[model samples]
Target: MKEWWRGAVVYQIYPRSFLDTSGDGTGDLPGIIQKLDYIANLGVDAVWLSPFFPSPMRDFGYDVANYCDVDPLFGSLEDFDALVSQAHALSLKIIIDQVYSHTSDQHEWFMTSKMSHDNEKSDWYVWADPQPDGTPPNNWQSVFGGPAWTWDNRRRQYYLHNFLSSQPDLNLHNEDVQDALLNVARFWLDRGVDGFRLDALNFGMHDETLRNNPPRQHFETEPTRPFDFQEHAYNLSHPELPVFLERLRSLLDQYQNERFTVAEIVGPEPLQEMKDYTKGSNRLSAGYSFDYLYADDLSADLVRNVSADWSDAGDSGWPAWAFSNHDAPRVNSRWGGENADAETAKLFAMLSLALRGTVFLYQGEELGLPQAEIPFDRLQDPEAIENWPETLGRDGARSPMPWTENDHYAGFSTVDPWLPIDMRHYALAVDLQQRDEKSVLSFVRDLIAFRKSSDALKTGSLVFLDTPDDVLAFTRGTDEGQVFCIFNLGRTQANLDLPLCTQTEIKFSNRSAKTSVLPETIPAMTGYWL
Candidate 1:
């Protein structure tokens, strides 16, 4: 089988905001099908759709109610089949989000387990008796807020939930549960999914002893939730996670196609966890963290640190990189700051594509969309609402995609969308950029094409080059060819003596000085590939 995912570019689509063919104020599978050509035109190798299964909307589709079917809100099983067929016709591989750690309370497994202690499925979910004083099993806190355990009157025991109470964690220690989850994967594999983005894979299991987490040393200010007060040593990231991952990979091997899996790992020290998860061929294909997604600034030191870690991650380990996604603020607003413009956006595109791994490009990122300003009344994300004013909620990044400026709701839908479209996004609409030669959209298309055409940029090794304080420079190469990638990640222009070589072709650049000889100065937020 061909490992097509190696250094491939995957486009992430949050179905709720991509396009709404259905007039029910929400985007659906048909909507994604309608935009398949638009996605293919961007030159991405695959399209990863966020969860579309039946969900109660508490945590959106992360709380899966059915493992094998699509939600009526999105479409039906037939709609999904049509989507897969259309996506394949465009030569776009389909990767779906798989929330394995938790499921909605409405799930049949949870319903049967909650009915009685003697039920056939009683041990499917994580359940424990209260303490002597009827308190929660431990001091663990949910990612949202409050205690991680919620009491159930029917079962007369507290069930574990690392997130919202409605989303209960599964008992991954149970071999039965593991078998059931693997079957769910088989069902999707039969349906033609090329890969899965495993959501919170580390949270699938817990300490059987139910031990309290140790307190963390003071580093930053007060945290958004009590969950951050500790190192999360006992409540999550159990030693058994790697074992489960091995079993998942074995299941993928059962199929003839070269199926892939990328785990979404988030912990205090995710770099080591990422390495452990992808240590060998028996484990995951790749993994990513909140590294750059939540970063306050993009700097030379940060890139060098991450690059060094992955370089030391051993031969079989692979890394997947992303700068923005549905859960975090846009890069233009995060790193670009107030002075962000078309130039900065173009530079970021070059930098991300030049990295040494598979890259994920989120919706609206190609247009250089900044974070939207959503009012308190317009907020829909539970985490944002609970920690408002303190954190810039994710809803701003998940707003409807602006397709055209003249149409109502920016051509996303005829009726109002679940989340309002950002007014500023109208000027950067796809239709407008399609006509402008120098738009961010056009620059991204050109960058992707350049990366695809160059063996050095697509599947080469990386070596960090010694450069100035504000400049991030690296050389990507193979025995056949090599090229230098340099970016001025600062707000002011940087002047430096760049390393040079023969056959120094200028493959791509933004506001850059085009020359075979090294340019003495690079403009602020500019990037060049040589």
Candidate 2:
């Protein structure tokens, strides 16, 4: 019943790779149940378990067939209930993913909808009559590198899919589809789930007019598609979508605690879109975009820009921050070199917590694990299947969570893992480092405790310090006082002219890396909060 997501730390668990109790090389509810303690120990407030619904697994569970039931690969309804009980028992809220934007073509609704053009289930999905040339209904291209529309031979029409051809986009424009999604939410809410992580929520609505997206003008930039080429003014972020978000909020509010919904909007214009989705009190509680996840650099100016972007987002809405997720390469890989060390990773984790918003921590991020160097033959992600050299795919970031050293599969499973266990991560495993005073894991614990005790870091205003590049300085403040936080984002020991923030207490340090600010010198690659 508590609205605790504000400034909360959410631990994202990709169910398939977190553990493999079934020994089928994929993780399941029992595996998650066994590892609830690991999640609880991380000091996160909640766990956003990625989709485990009835799925065809073509997209590795993103293509949902049934929203209300657990897939056999994961477990049964009773298994989910047990997982929920275990999480709550550990004082952790459970937020499951809701893939409402599309469903596996195998879904009953899609099956029925594809049977006949005027069938009762027709219009539940985004379908259109083929052009006179019998090509796709529109110029829209699938995100996986082809036509977004797949011709349904039975109905003699083309169905829309933002992703693969096997996953058909739902027509949220249809009132019945909206009702059906809400019913799915109701099913989970009644089952005692805390919230829903709306996958590609902005993609729920498309332009009813079926207008063709404009051409890409910038040739120097990456190639554009129907997906990324246009401003997407009409195809997505439709004015009608928020009405449904409000409806979703209205339904969630019926339960004692209004359940949270965080939309995943990926594009060049995500900041504005995030704001739009969480604009009014009636819509979603928070929205997290892919700014940090996709960024290759972590400059101080970039941090300041994000903070200023949402300085006045208001209580009706808030920003949720995540540096990495399944879709992204680990920050360590994106921001590599000496700066990718454990200490720097610890600092980033602390800085994320100190920011005035909710933080979503990927599985191995707390341990400072970089992207796994997955070989070409061992890859399992569809993205990798499509584009290998240019992209490492999500599997590189999802190697099993290392738990112990000197054990096969890094203690993640009793059998072979879906992906090879990174032996280099063994030294950073939980069992090995829990006792160390200087471990990233320990720093995370200390930082989470600090966040819990400090009002400034929890629900306060953040002002970026006028510090130089490579050295990020910010003051998190409540009416109680100010907490000064600084991070040396670079490798070399750089000196900066400190303005007003001269006298400061060291609240926490992620690294002993040195630095010099006008008069006094600090350690390199270190982070400090006062």
Candidate 3:
């Protein structure tokens, strides 16, 4: 609560895509430590690291086989400690992902649990007996695809997996499982982690009776998989999740410094669930949704709707926002698809930062970078390969960060990169952007610094200022005063008469032009915070 992640700017670094040092082609902890200066220079208050724990990497380290140690692929535990030390030395807090909802099937606890129904860890995972026909226990589908229930011959039972079958969901109803997971979290807290971005926190609990989820009125079709058809009411977002979150927060409270926990809770009825989980101080610090990341456009109504819903939810339940991350494609691609404008991308970054809560800037977002185009032969993400064409999936978003243009691998690795460096990204490399005053990266640093110095924008209340199509406008203010923010989301100019407001100044603009110039038309992909 003290380090400013609430209404603060947090940078997300997907380890595999950030910067590689081992020549093995994958980015690691040491690489991250080396790049801390770059991250710190961006004026972010915190760094949110995706999973780095030991794993078979079925879901790129989300499938943890060990909670305490760093994987050999990422480097030794010493590397993690070193990274943590270096990050803190720069006064940058570190918030690592905690995937306690599930572990890889290869995890010792799951292996032992699946071996028998009466083992010491048998109840650690969600297990149910097969029906009389010997089919799966329920008809629920995995987020990855197919049945959520995976049959294991060893125990003659089906284990629950909200995601992939490899990621067997943990049974939070079991006291021992909850205790063990909290102890795992405490280990990191003792080792000096400032917080955890709790992965799939709502997934900790499931229907104990193994009830079948009712058929959906609509299965939201996407380019990803066939699994989007159902409402997912039973498989996830159970009412019991808040109890576990409160329990998790209780453990975090015992830590020395002000340790925070932000839950990545998504699915149906997220607004209410997000509020319940974070409303009281005894629970999580904050929670976010897939709303913005899944969107193809950022519109005025969409922005106001989410903010108004959270505002209606009550004040204590804070919200955190992001437009892109390791799981979602780059916002540029989402906004512009195949032909995205660099100008539009920069405008989008500014738009998200001006929202009501703390902002999350995924790596490369500041550079106005588009998603990396992964070829079929070199595609590293299973989700992308599973469902291609319609869904570019997340692999495109996880490509290695381009630090330079001359190097064969864009200065990301000495060996062939884990994923090929897109030629488009090389030209927008950090080295080039840092030198360009008009670059998106410099604009990002300026925006963050401005947000920090101004208390109104930093911890302000958001009020929607109405606007027409392809434009977003709002006012962010506190007890001190207010600043009116506006954006044109289209490539062509948006013509509109300004709303008459007295105490407004052109506080910030994504473009070079000032708001007072009174051009008859707002230029393409331009915005101003007044």
Top-TM-score candidate index = 1
Candidate 2 runs further than 4 Å off: 219-221, 224-227, 313-316, 513-519, 522-524
The lDDT of each candidate is 0.89, 0.82, 0.82
> What is the Cα-based lDDT of residue 88 in candidate 3?
91
Per-residue lDDT tens digits for candidate 1, residues 284-386, read 9997757789788899999998777777335748889999999999999999888788888888899999998889999999999999989999999999999
| Candidate 1 vs candidate 2, TM-score winner | 1
Q: How do all the candidates rank in terms of lDDT, highest first?
A: 1, 3, 2
User: Total clashes, candidate 1?
Assistant: 0
Looking at model 3, residue 402 earns an lDDT score of: 92
Supply the global lDDT for candidate 1.
0.89
TM-score of each: 0.98, 0.95, 0.95
Query: Candidate 2 lDDT, tens digit per residue, 369-472?
Result: 98888888898887787777876688878888888887878888888888887777888898878889788888888888788777788778888766666788
Best by lDDT: 1
Which candidate do you rate higher for TM-score, 1 or 3? 1
* lDDT score for candidate 2 against the true structure: 0.82
Location of the lowest summed lDDT over 10 successive residues in candidate 2? 513-522
